[model samples]
Target: MMELGPKPRRRTPTVWVGPVPIGSDHPVVVQSMTNTDTADAEATAAQVIELARAGSEVVRITVNREEAAAAVPRIVERVRAAGYATPLVGDFHYNGHVLLTRYPECARALDKYRINPGNVGARQKDRNFAQIIEVALKYEKPVRIGVNWGSLDQDLLTELMDANARRPDPRSAREVLLEAMVESALRSARFAEELGMPHDRIILSAKVSEVQDLIAVYRTLAARCDYPLHLGLTEAGMGMKGIVASTAGLAVLLQEGIGDTIRISLTPTPGGDRAEEVRVAQQILQSLGLRTFLPQVSSCPGCGRTTSTFFQEMARDVQAYIQRRLPEWRRRYPGVETLKVAVMGCVVNGPGESRHADIGISLPGTFEEPTAPVFIDGEKYTTLRGDDIVPRFLQILEDYVARRFGRDGDGKRAAAPAGREAAAPTRRGEEDAGGVAAGSAARSEAGRPGRPAAGTPAGSAGGRAAGT
Candidate 1:
């Protein structure tokens, strides 16, 4: 474990969710949950093993009741036994602390517990908070206080309704919803403090299904408090839309320095791996420069300028190839987070985009110089045509992965050398970890709903929700 400075006071992060530090200037975290039934030890352990291999910094699984809690120790042990120490977080809903207290073994097994602030019943709120805190305190595990508007406290909702009885505006509902989450979270943390827990022992969030609402509440909380925030778009759907929506919202908050950790929740597909959720989240954070993962791929969206379908196919093929061979990559490259490969559709933008990548291929049309341009370490090394693309591209990437990233056995940081900003990573939505100098400006240009494409893309932090 790397030794860090003595933890600070108020701004100090509550708990380190994983092995890595993830608060108060620490790199943003990327995490996901297991799709395997928590009750099924063999199936769940198998899923955890796969997730660990996929570069998931943290793995969460629902521990809805006692049966699920009983499975925690076995699953967690299986993860460690598999030789990967990916931090496990027990996702608890109602009566969570009861399970933790009854099965103290769970407290000893997992690294963190994600508690939904909105669901714990008011009548049992204090008891629930204390029970969970007791478990966390016993193990020194960090807690993520997650709040979703969809599952808001019934009592708080009623109180909010009563408070707005005189001049009720619909906006009041949103405001109350956001405020209620923050207030409930603060209340829970206060209990932790009263119970003698340290300040850096927790993370907080007010996640929502709506992007605007999620961004709004988080921004509000960050401005007022200093707790490390966990960002997510709860129940974010699947496919490109789910990934984009979650990224868009999270990117906005992350750029502004609001989120300490994040997850991109995708709808689980039948027979589909849920761990991919963590990978996609990692890619988003890495692309935005918030976290690191498998080498960053700067593949292009093919257009009329594209020479052949080869470039597009090459991109998919290389990714698949890497996926199949990750064990070897990790074994060989030691500390390489990703392979830093780029596959551009055309030479026009490809060449420039390829510069930041470790290995790159820029497909070209009939050219004066070469049929295709390939760059290694930013130098035009060779030209390949026709069927030569895939093999040559893979060769360059492998060389870059080996030389820059080193073999998997050697301990080295494959991340690019840091620049001036290591002094202080900017607040959310300002600059992504990608160091792309251009973020919201590019997003503004990408086009918004009714807004002009003449403007830049809406930031990942989120614009003013969908309304204002």
Candidate 2:
């Protein structure tokens, strides 16, 4: 198979947020900010734990006021006592310098401090920025020089605007803003290094709401510095629009190998799930083949043949089941997140696709017999009908998990399961008893003994199978 997707990651200076490493050959990190009021230490700490459980490597909480800053140490203590070692980041804007100075405990408690250079004010911009850096240097903590387009440094923006006007054809306001964003981040990083902070202790981010603008700013920053870049599309609106926009922006940069750590800034609706942001980030990374956090449910978009919503309902249930059981499963089955389960509908491409999954089920469609075939390791294992289809398939799935990953009598996990190629047995030109067949071409391409042929279904060639 040919190499695809992201180019090799650009080299960047490594920075550690607690024990987790960012940049320079390490896996891309997923992070998120808590929406809870930081002044309420207990609530903030609880949400932090929740985000950590949802796979956020680092959790950020706003430290905008003295009360919030004062609560930091308590929040940190609670999270640590609860057995989560995930790093907590302090997101500071206008008053960070003062809060970090007056509340030394807050400075000590946080693993990292994020300073937005844009809102640090024009008259005391340098002084305020320097104060924040001094505290970070004193604590020996990593600092992210975050520059937001909305709260950009007015002084730098004004200067860039002036310079643009001198050109024969003046640049647009957007171009000037982009330049200012990059300039603000680089200048802040350089200043921190000058103040005796090591380059590796610094991370950088320049966020803009527009997808194209966000990409442009990060690409410029990546070219100019080796600092680890934090990727985000700030102020992306709520619901599907936010998810799509954030994914589009982050995916483009990630594929080009530009980001180190990422957070999806989605505006949650009233009483919405905060952990949804973390899931979105995980899905984006997993979809791009960058990381795996949970077992994936591959389901198909129902067409005319699938008249009933049985497959759709089954897909949702399977996904929910995986999510609910994932935490326990992780402790019990070390690599279960890599398991792929397909729940395909109809006979058109169902069996061919089902054979590619580790475990899969193909349910009957309209005008067809009401039976479902379950395949394990690319071979037809059993068939089911009536009300037991879901339960039977789930049982087989659980059994497969236990057999493949359950611990031995000695309390240690069993040997790692074989790869798909080894598990898939070659049938030559024979069809299974269920009227389902695995193509000879698929078997041959899988490096088994068979002849090559064309017209294989989408998920049949030893790849991710279609589900639902």
Candidate 3:
């Protein structure tokens, strides 16, 4: 049988961006770029903070002009003031060398510099590239040699095309293009190292718009060098189109374990939320089992057996409750982000599915009894009924989270509340009118696998119930 799961992450030298490190040794990093104007320090800083809170480990802002370059220090200062140490990367183009030289503070404030090798200038290409590398070396900051298909070096492409034409069995134009993208990234990386940047202080990216092209480019690029490649499908359109394209391309390579850091280049609609990109990047990583940033609610789509909308409303409320409580839970319950929940509307798969979650609620179907069974640790904990079902289930969820994940003031295990011991399993028709069945029992906290100890944060795979 074929082995399954994400390939072993490709080994590479680690590069520290402020306090965060990127390499095969660390978790795959999620990053985003602010669409806000970098010259507007207040707006940029606000968006950076939002992105960081939304789980962007690294945030980049364009530093194209003098004003933008001047604002870099203020932006970094404001973000730090907001209590976020999320590393900032300055995106530079043609004038990067001059701007970095003129605004020493900007260069010093930024955690990393991202320069497109194709746009550094035609005649002064080598000189400009070296200038940015020199500043990075001086400040001890890492550099990302980002190569985009739209901005690919024409000189290099022409050279490769001409060389390919001489071969007796030349590859297709698309094949040559992919090779050029990989070559541009690898060659620039080698040059940066020669210009004094250490191997661990450099990152590489070669992005293309189309899904297949991106996969082809990154696969070749990842094989040729171990510089911790940054992955993305550039110009991935807008709305669902962008999300689908980006996910398709990034997922394929990530499953093969080729990328170290990732960004979803989504084109948001006017007035759309800028933080959506951060969320999408997070979902991709989470879905691939690479990282966990929030509580995951597993819900089934409504079917004919579930005619009423009560289950629908319950699922939404449950998700909203988790979202609202996550901030407090993350601090108080070190491993709560890994919590798995199920909200099933019908009895067909409800109980079985609910039994598989850390905490779950299986609601009644049409013509079935109105009681909703709440399961904890694969056992029926209680039954909720009538108009009180939603609220009762939510309370049980809150109690379970606190009892299982909460820590004490002295950083010790928080004992279950008085009178909170596991009740004996309940029988039919035994539920009280107030909504909860008295005899149902919750799981005992002791000896539970994946229970987060006092001070340790939950591992990527912990905080979930067994058999899930």
Candidate 4:
């Protein structure tokens, strides 16, 4: 037999915002909002630059009125002057068409514009969408249609309510809500198509406060359209609950290749910088191996065996330590994300879970032979005992990061590591995945080896893991 070459490799991005790609084949990009008064150019530009430094690749500003639109010129000029080249998004609610028309410079300055279809106009939302499309065409910008559950068009809600009266199911309210969002997006996108707007010029967000609702609506929308989807669970509470719920919801979607971009909207702590939400977005993505604005630290969930308050305190203390010393680490190493630092409570699956990690400390527990081993690059380098383990673990992490991102003056981004080559898999192998075809590509990212999630699992690869 003749020798055959490796299977042809191809990768597809999970989401596209106009020409901007996100998720999967593309690097995860972070976005944040400007807290400045929209009309104040200097203040808004400063905030935008600050947010970009915090890892916000895209910055959205509220354009509630024409004054905000008028401020765009100065905002654009100031942002450029600061040398922070983050893309700006205009948020339009009631009269997007007016600002988009009268403020060509502002629209042009904005890399993308956001429109809330429910609040765009009183009637014939399509006409309003058309008006906005003209501005996008004139400026050659992309648009994101953001639809919130609380702000669904009253007419659609009423109609959906009438349908729910006959269906009589627990999921009726949510089904109707999802129907409205998908319908709204599809309708608006149809208008954009009619006016000859390229599909790349459109992105859509269907955000609800509840995670389940957000997932359901977005799931339905993704199945139906090829447009880039922006994922968010809007107003998702504060503190731990917000983090848990948002992560849970997005984790489910991202595993299935449903999300293009994600935002974890968190309520800012009192007297704290609102940029925390943006940081959360970067952290979650980094943890999942989705994005790389920060270092990845893996700490095992504490259990009975070898459990210690010391481990708990250390995990948190180490996190803070990394953040404080990150600038120095960046000075030393150029691409810190390629280095992984693991802190495990015990052995169990700790080593396996973090096997690919660059460095890890497997605490003395059931899995570790006395004089617990500390692993670097998949092999044990030393046996750590006594009270020296924690500090040593932290030190190893710092050295690893320093070796990667660099220790240059004032801490700047160094060159990224050599690219990892990925080839798309051949076929789906889901055990209980429905509607999967013979040659459909399987999602090989998760550890399950093509198992669908619980509850809902269908993906573009044509099958789903059930239950999130």
Among all candidates shown, the one with the greatest lDDT: 3
| Tens-digit lDDT string for candidate 2 (289-393) | 877666788888999999899999988877776655555565566567788999999998888778898888899999989998888888888777777566556
Q: What local lDDT does model 3 show for residue 121?
A: 81
lDDT of 3: 0.79
Error of 3 at 79 (Å): 0.8
Best by TM-score: 3
**lDDT per residue, candidate 3, 1-468, as tens digits?**
897789999999877675556788767777889988899999999988777666677889999999999999999888777556667899999999999999999999998999899999878999999999999989989999999988889999999999999999999988988888889988999999888889999999999999999998888888888999899988888999999999999999999989998999999999998878878987898888887667889888989999999889889988887766665666567667778999999899999999999889999999999898888888887777667676667667777887777774342223322433232222332111111111111112244343323222222122211001
User: How do all the candidates rank in terms of lDDT, highest first?
Assistant: 3, 2, 1, 4
Report how far residue 416 has shifted in candidate 3, in Å: 12
Total clashing pairs for each candidate: 46, 5, 0, 27
Winner on lDDT between 2 and 4 is 2
Off by over 4 Å in 3: 2-4, 408-468
Query: What are the lDDT scores of the predictions, listed in order?
Result: 0.66, 0.78, 0.79, 0.65
Global lDDT of model 1: 0.66
Name the better of 1 and 2 by lDDT.
2
Question: Every model's Cα RMSD, please?
Answer: 13.3, 12.4, 9.7, 13.1
